[model samples]
Target: MSIKIRGSNAYGHSGWFTVYCRICNRKLKIGTDLVYKCPKCEKKYNAYFCEADARGLKWKCPYCNTELVPVI
Candidate 1:
């Protein structure tokens, strides 16, 4: 599954996506930050994680109990 962008309607920005780490509350920017995305829960939960947090969780989604995939 693809990472769904939430609240995309901002001033002058059309297709920009702002994602955050689920565990650290850190802002994750595409092309700069390595993010783990929950394939099963992204649309519903908007679950994204930093590399360390994702590894800490054993590459699993804590909410949906599904395997987390890295966003490349």
Candidate 2:
């Protein structure tokens, strides 16, 4: 047998986005992208996946018209 690498470096489900609604805090059943558009206001979001891994991207809440100021 040859001495070679025999492992995998593939991206699995746990390392990717869960694709859910931030406002509703529910997993989306239709969206299929890193960016999710709110059906109600057509607003896109990175989504708050969890407390340890928040994807709280700054963007305007089209529904509420609230400017999500960037935390710079």
**Number of the top TM-score candidate:** 1
Candidate that scores best on lDDT = 1
Across residues 1-72, which tens digit of lDDT does each residue of candidate 2 receive? 856533353444333334555665666433343344433343344532322222453454545555443221
Off by over 4 Å in 2: 1-9, 29-35, 38-72
Where does model 1 exceed 4 Å of error?
Answer: 1-15
The residue pairs in collision within model 2 are: none
Candidate 1 CA-lDDT value: 0.83
lDDT of each: 0.83, 0.41
**For each candidate, C-alpha RMSD in Å?**
8.5, 10.8
Give the TM-scores of the predictions, in the order they appear: 0.73, 0.26
Error of 2 at 63 (Å): 7.2
